[model samples]
Target: MSGNSSRRSPVERFFRMSLYVFAGLVLLQLSLALLAEIWPWLLGIGIIAGGISITVWWLRHRNTW
Candidate 1:
């Protein structure tokens, strides 16, 4: 309402981008999990990748990396 240009600040842009990436990763996990359900070996790999993604996200936010 203040007639501002509504530009995103650097932190806001980073947050938005990270959120989108996190959502995309989750979607990918779902797809891979489904495939893994059909072929069991992929289950372990998919889970490991998911864990790594979460760990990386935690590290990023913790250290602003």
Candidate 2:
């Protein structure tokens, strides 16, 4: 039989929610990064790209939490 089949506690749930939130933020940052390539009204692709790079790090780590 398996030895790790129990429900999560409240703290675990909190962590799970936070992880998803961070991941979502990362996706938003990524969208902003790509938006510059499609839209010409903006002039900050470099900044958005930098932001996406950093957020991607958080996204990968959050997936583990």
Candidate 3:
């Protein structure tokens, strides 16, 4: 009975799971708010990086095909 007593009940487990979900949602909302503020900069950098990557790949592989 000592081991069983140490284990959490279903209600306690459900509460813990709900708490985790709530915390994760709070964190996700905060991160999205921050991302919204910096999204344009991120989008610009992503586009430039992607363009450069494609250019480099084309230059290296253009003659292979």
Candidate 4:
């Protein structure tokens, strides 16, 4: 049981890290959107890039998390 729990700890850590990364990406995209009035293209690019990054992260970590 102890060994199993130890193995699970890494998965939990990875999950927590991914969550933080996702949150940061969201904030960045929101900031870009807010600045879109000056550079209208940035909001669209940020949304697309953020979506792709989150999708890739989810795919890579889905099994572990």
Candidate that would win on TM-score:
3
- Give lDDT tens digits, candidate 2, residues 1-65: 46565777899999999999999999999998898676764546767888999899989999999
TM-score of 3: 0.73
Error of 4 at 32 (Å): 0.2
* TM-score for all models, in order of appearance: 0.50, 0.50, 0.73, 0.45
- In terms of lDDT, the poorest run of 10 residues in model 1 is 1-10
Model 2 error, position 12 (Å): 0.5
lDDT of 1 by residue, 1-65 (tens): 66566777899999999999999999999998887777766677789999999999999899975
| Candidate 3 per-residue lDDT over residues 1-65, each given as its tens digit | 57888999999999999999999999999999999999999999999999999999998899787
lDDT of 1: 0.89
Maximum-lDDT candidate: 3
Error of 3 at 54 (Å): 3.4
Q: Which stretches of candidate 1 lie over 4 Å from their true place?
A: 1-4, 39-65
Q: What's the residue-level lDDT of 38 in candidate 2? A: 68
Regions of candidate 4 where Cα sits further than 4 Å from its true position: 1-8, 38-65
